[model samples]
Target chain A: MSDREVGGAAEAAAAVIPGSRAMLAVIARSLSPLHGQVTVPQFRILVILADSNVALRSGDLAKALDVHPSTLVRMADRLVARGLIRRSENSASRRETLIELEPAGLDVVRTVTRRRQRDLRRILERMTSGERAAFVDAMQSFTRAAAADADADLTSFGL
Target chain B: MSDREVGGAAEAAAAVIPGSRAMLAVIARSLSPLHGQVTVPQFRILVILADSNVALRSGDLAKALDVHPSTLVRMADRLVARGLIRRSENSASRRETLIELEPAGLDVVRTVTRRRQRDLRRILERMTSGERAAFVDAMQSFTRAAAADADADLTSFGL
Candidate 1:
């Protein structure tokens, strides 16, 4: 397609599809309380840790976040200083340290998550049950497609 | 509700709703090309400028982005240094400057937008037409609600 056609198509798609920009705006607002307390990446780490049933090794957590080990370590240091996360020597391996969320970190995650859900629930309440069901279905399909694409890309890179 | 109950409700909502985290992960993957070139916030500026028909004054742009004037100024400086955006004297006012996308900036916006659409379309193709319609309807509702919330917050804060 010509550049103009491409631009038009993109605009049209943006109008119909759930633009990430809008989703992000809502999310940012929901997480406003955590603004100065932790950066988004650090908050993400807290969420991951809070959700895990067992402590994760620093390297494993870094891999899960797709961040460099050094970068993860720095973030972990900050979280530790803030008393949001704790790092302990892995009993299974003396050379490795495991990371887990502190009670404060878990509280932060729960607070932000509850606020986010309340915001979403308010939005959802405005829609019909049918609309909600369809949205859930569509989202599941989209999420699967996106995941497949990511897997393909990873495979291509021999990951 | 108890904390556990609240956590359970949030998890249930996350399962049914189009969670912003998933939406963001998809968007980040789609925009991976812009990585190391420009930050996400800078790219957002490019998008806003590209979408607008006329140049936007710094104050207006900052308001549109819900960011501080100083922060916007710093971001504008970085974009200017990168040659992706140009700050020109607003003909209407000598004291204020207007921001517009340069050709390079427009190109970047188009490229990223096209990829984003392609990714979304690939996902959409897997859905039924009814599902697509419902998704659109639900998204429109959610976006409007989110915008209203933001507006109410701004008004409350006298912004």
Candidate 2:
């Protein structure tokens, strides 16, 4: 897996790229049961709201989600239909309508999170202590480094 | 960050949980530019097709994507309209529609991947050699272990 000629980034990418897909697969499986209940995009929106602990302006949410305003409107429309989220009355006239997660929306986040935690725990337990400790240390280091990077992506509904 | 009382899974989860969000943020940032060009859900479908390298049966694709049949059809409907993918004529009456990625669809996956690689490389390069090595080893180890786990998620469009 080491490409001496393509040192640094390319080699590093080659070494760890497979892990990205594996990690995503882990998350996706957690979302499987709720497939019909909520689309992936909707779930992301719910996560951001849950993390923020407050209603978000539609425009701000759209920007954070990296969707066009119209697209957010459309996605929000579906959420409204499903009653996972709703538009809060906005007293601030200059700002866009504020959207808030409903109790139902919180359930989706909780369900998937609980599932992922269980799966991750199972996998972690199977690893030798060296592998498990390395896994955790590397993950934490990467997160810390990436979060500090100005270029770190803001798109995942600000997840 | 260590929770002594919550050993094993709970402890491991604590160490790596933050990284999960950071890693997702990295991916979400890569997908940011494609926000309007392709909705996140739609992009996911295209990625599945691109990776598969052949027309996928609508039913199988739906199952692999972990989406309801009706939802896949709806998502595919937009993709078809946008010319990112198309329905291939299927001779077998028993099979559902076959979806093939168009040139346009390939382009989208390529763009995001290129961006993500560039971003990841930059991040990897900034790390100490030890950190980078741990990342590669841990990532590969985790991918291998998770892939082997019978309970590992299959909901991420077979990615």
Residues B102-159, candidate 2: write the lDDT tens digits. 9999999888887777777877877887888889989988887786785522524422
lDDT of 2 at B85: 97
Model 1, A43-148: lDDT tens digits are 8788777666578899988887788999999999999999999999877899999998889988898888677777666555545555555556655765665566
Worst 10 residues of 2 chain A by lDDT: A150-159
Give every candidate's TM-score on chain A.
0.74, 0.84
Give the residue spans of candidate 2 off by over 4 A.
A1-6, A32-42, A53-63, A66-108, A151-159, B1-6, B68-78, B90-97, B151-159
- Tell me the lDDT of candidate 1: 0.69
Assess candidate 2 and give its lDDT: 0.78
Q: Model 2, A14-74: lDDT tens per residue?
A: 5666687777667666677686788787888898888888999998888777779999999
Write down the C-alpha DockQ for each prediction: 0.27, 0.49
| Weakest ten-residue segment in model 1 chain B by summed lDDT | B150-159
Mark the regions of model 1 whose C-alpha exceeds 4 Å error after superposition: A1-15, A18-21, A140-159, B1-19, B128-130, B144-159
